[model samples]
Target: MANERWNLNTTSDLTAEPGTPVGLVNQPRTAAQRLTDRPSDYGEQIVPPKPLWYLDKAGEPHSLGVNEPHQFLLFWRSNVGDKAADLDDSYYMGVTGLQGVGVAGHRVTINATGEVLQPGGESSATISGFWDKSDPDDPMWTPIEPETEYTVTVAAHNQSGEFGPDSDELTITTPAVGYDTQQLTLPPRPPNDVDFAAPLPVITTSGGGGIQLRWTTVPNVTKYEIFDNPTPGTTDGMDSSRPGLNSRDVKLGEVNQPSAGTPTVTFTTPAYTTPRRRFALKVRAVRTNSYGTAYSEFSTPLRGALPASTVAPGTPGAPTLTVSPVVGGQVKLTISPPTINASNGAPEYYAVYDGTRQVAVVSSPLGAAPHVTLQYAAAQGYSFTVAAGNSVGVSNPSSALTGTVPTPAAPGAPTAVAVTNVTTTGLAVNWTAPASANPPVTSYKVYDGSTVKATVAAPATTTNLTGYSPQTAYSIQVAAVNGTGEGSKSSPAVTGTTPAT
Candidate 1:
């Protein structure tokens, strides 16, 4: 019970019999008033450790060890409580008064007893905690200065998030410059290292219909900052007044580097759009410690290379297609640009597909809708779909439009016509059916010297011409007919003559 101290149970308990020793228990306090008579005290007071020289430079005397602004003498408690095993595992050391250090306070993990190297090859017993400033919301231990007297303090933290009272204050004095043996001075350097170059970020498609950015990992980098230039090639500098680097550059987001994994950041929301979409992307490495944060210069866009979009445009909407019958057994496919949402930007082109097979890729022409004319067999069924595509990738195909070219317009003219049987009054005209008839040759018309002599139904290539003048020669021609109407007459009319009756 050596670590346990007497604490006020409550303000009302002060009224108890002076020597009663009643209502007093050594149980650890869980409330704000449990540590001492002060209502503000919550946890038990922790024992303070002796301050030791914080020597970062070799051959430096202990009296002049605080050479760097970020260096501080080591202060730690061997064990948080009497039980070294239990307290060290269950409690943490909360250090305050590390002026010029990170965010004014820090919660450092307890380190096993170690040694700090001293001058003349001598070593001092030291069990210190590592400084942590990665989380902006958490306590930050900033830089410490040399030749200054610092009032440092420490408190114990329980597993339940309760803090013990501050330990006895310790005033540690840093040696003044030009001490006995010329005190060591820290090398001149900027608080943060900004000379390193950042890796260029690459934008790629995400499996979840979003976009992902990746970059090479940098050593000692805790996180990566991503910036996008909406207008590529602009020389605008980052403006602090705005959200991103400048009026043109916007910070996409920051990704914490995992201990072991590819450096990547994925944005699932705020999908990309055109005209306002990110044209190029850059990345910078960030490192933080007790000294502060150091950032590498943002990677510049590669020369003569298109910058990756902050977010690849989302898959575009399916394109609408219209099919019309063109002359000569061809079908004209007119495509209406898909209704691209703001997130999809503008499509660069369209892909036309027949069933699952791709048939054509139609680039968007200036001031005109995309169209393609394809030869189609008359009356043959057709199924067509179109998909919109952009710089990133293609979209899902639109709904299928099913249709076929109109049946062949009127069959071709009869191939051959001749007067086979010549009679005094009438003669029989025979001809071959027209080839390339879509609906098949349905009927034919016989012409005698530019006059319609007779009409015959299809399957009967021959027709009899009656009422012709006897002993007169006649010019005979034949024409094919279909659902659309009659076709051209056979070329070069055949002549026939009848013997005198």
Candidate 2:
């Protein structure tokens, strides 16, 4: 092929008036501009088309785009002013450099190709490629001022390395991500629209299980940042770090929620000893997934509303449930009008009190009157209280209301107790054939000295020595008893175990 240089005129007409934070205008061309080649009088008219532009990631060009991501602009024009065949589907893109623009050095950029995008090219060629800041003068280093308009022109090269001539140039503005527009600069806007809400859904469950959150949707949000702060001992349910505190300062935990529309957040809390726990949670729109994390403003704090347990009622409605003289046993209890009465049941909570301190509390459903119980054993002075469980927590114990569980008659001393030593099975056959054993000796209440060792039935005499595998010495006894009749315990127990033989 003979060496030849086809002279081609190239230009465009896109303009960025002024004070506009200039950036890539990535719009496609119009059909009219692609259909007919128009002629102009001021010489700022339509001209011949240009070649396509592609990203070449080799040892040629490299630059970060809008989001500072590793991507470049791509442009292509016709070799002949005529509509070019489907050349778009013919090529792809890469990284590094293409044409003559690339990373000149670390911070500086370089672009030297006799091309400075001017406003004269038609509205068709989409410019896409390297964008560098450092410019070096190997060939011709021309510094492109940020926010300045420049022209990019493309030319067609034949397969055998021949020029099809110059194509029309497209105009574009270059602006670093931060350069602002006049005075109304773009405030830190989330990458795209973010979905969120003030006072969003918040909740806490039994035992500080976890805090849950949910919100609205956003178009281009990648992830969500959730925050929580403890409003310890707070009576008013408000989600916030007491005023003037940094979110982190008031932070309980930060959670990452999905940006898939539904605004949901959650953070688990540690175990709780107190009857009730409370907290405040807030949400912020964020996106760490993209090159530059796009973040939306924080939503107002939303105090999670937990189901507050209500206070137990006074004066039993149902049959009086005798609290087994045992500690930690609860009983079915409820307030007067089971329904919450804003007036009387307004803030009260159900608690089993032992004169001074409260032993148990129903701390949720703040108004529901449900069964409540005394967690501790009956002390000399003990009574129940449908105490208020509110901002100030369960109110001072309810009442030492004249209540008493008649002390159980000293259980009649057990009777007819008996015992035997078995050498063959290495077992203690202790039993009581008391006449009261008709009720089926529930268990032969046995004791080693004053300490109760074992409680077995008399009918079932042979007490297996499994617990004491080796020939360990043992003392055992038995007693005959029924729900109503407890008999005298067996006399001093006989010793036996896994035989020495």
Candidate 3:
């Protein structure tokens, strides 16, 4: 309703001309007398001249026919933008028209907000010449009648509700009804009568091999257009007024919202070459309507690196495995970075795997021997491998490394020893095996008075000692042996005696 309302002369400037009776009603005053009124008499101030439109290189107005869709450019200025650093302010273009005969109260007035005008240049906006019959109650946009004469005037209204003087009148006469040739397409009005500024896009890696761009979805935006600095090495100079704003940009692509209720749109680069390249990117939102496509301002530029290679790096060499001596000790795997070439590219990090599953990833930069330690059960065997990886992808795994943790201790002592026969020169002995053995017991040893007398294979608990003198007494002991070496001698040595000859 505020758009439709306007102020007009209401109070007469009539005054007594000496002989005229004072306080007379309906008395008319001269135009000169109204001009002499004090400033206080007028409640509003006049702005710039009325907005003017289309003139050719010859400075002559172009003619339009009612049968064809007609459009024209409207130019106007405000107090703003008088200086170079000033920003353009929003304003309404007030249009009023008369058809055939000039009639009171029958004229139609329409106020529409136009596109933003840049400062320090010719400020202009495209305006439609005719209105559609979409609204039965609103006749301001109704098409002109055939062969009828129409009179139109445009004025600029500031946001503060002050109207400037009207422009020179624009008059048109419709041709015969059959003269139509072209259709008129008007641009869609901005949402809520205000233009939108596009939100900036966030650039990052797509995780696998390429660059990714993400941004917030704007309401009324049907699609988004992506732009990149044409040159890979140049930074974006985002001065909107300069020709570089659009001239230097290359349109990468455009995308629509994938689905409803989605708040973000993502774009990943296609497979890229090895030795990744960098990019400077920006985005803009667009909406299409009956009038035409409307675009939000371009977002700020973002710089990011793209994937280096499309192919995965080459397989790495086998890693070396080290087993600690103590049971349950850590097993360390030292990985050497894979060799890099044109075919393999360079690896960013190394991945350590146990059999087919990945156990850990070494995030260290390439060219270093990454040491990874894992706790292993005592004497348990393991098989592991390593691989190279980068943003592009992962390489084939390296040769497998197999090993086992060192046993924490030797086997437990042998038990249950008994001497069977005693003679002048020899004796027979047997014993029960130890209960626990790391790496499994492999042999047994016999000790006579602190000297190793004999060695026997595992699972055997019997032995014969034959070097004793005829009437001598001897102390005998047995111990278990395994991969970790022999255990302590059996406790409480058995006493044996030889008979005299």
**Which candidate has the top score in lDDT?**
3
TM-scores for candidates 1 onward, in order: 0.24, 0.32, 0.27
- What is the C-alpha local distance difference test score of candidate 2? 0.40
Ranking by lDDT: 3, 1, 2
Candidates, ranked, TM-score: 2, 3, 1
TM-score of candidate 1 relative to the true fold: 0.24
In terms of lDDT, the poorest run of 10 residues in model 3 is 98-107
Q: Model 1, range 1-501, lDDT digits (tens) per residue? A: 222334333323332444555554444444365433433333433222222222224522232223333345443432323322222222122233222111112232222111122211111122222344355367444344457655544444333344434444445554444332231222212112222133333323221122344445565566777666667766787577853367787677777766766543332223343222334666676767654666666666422222333322343333333433334466677776544343553555678888888888876522346777777776777788887766666677777877666666778888767777787988888888876776567788888877888888878988777886778988888888877788899999898688787
Question: What local lDDT does model 3 show for residue 302?
Answer: 76
Best by TM-score: 2
Error of 3 at 120 (Å): 36
Clashes of each: 11, 60, 6
Q: Tens digits of per-residue lDDT for model 2 on 1-501?
A: 122111122122233533433444335343244224333322321222234433234422212223112222433433232432343333323111223221111111113343323232222222333343244344343444555555555443322223333434445566555332211222233223223333322222222224334455444454555555655334544437444345343544444545465544444433322224444555555555335555566666654444343442222122133443322223334443123332322333455554556555654443233555443323333455545454434344433444443322212334444344545434454343554332244555666556666666545654543344456566765555555456565555565455665
Q: Choose 1 or 2, whichever is better by lDDT.
A: 1
Per-residue lDDT of candidate 3, residues 1-501 (tens digit):
111211233334334333444443555443334334434445433233334434444554432212322443344332222211111322222122211111111111222311222222233444444453345466344443456655555544433233444555556554443322212222222222111133222212222234566776766667877777746665546658643365467777888856878867787544333244455677777777654766766676676554454456788789886433423467777886666555665666688888887788875434556788887777777788998887779888889988776656788888888887888888888998888665578899988888888899978889898888898988889989887788888889998678899
lDDT winner between candidates 2 and 3: 3
The better candidate by TM-score, 2 or 3, is 2
Better of 1 and 2 by TM-score: 2
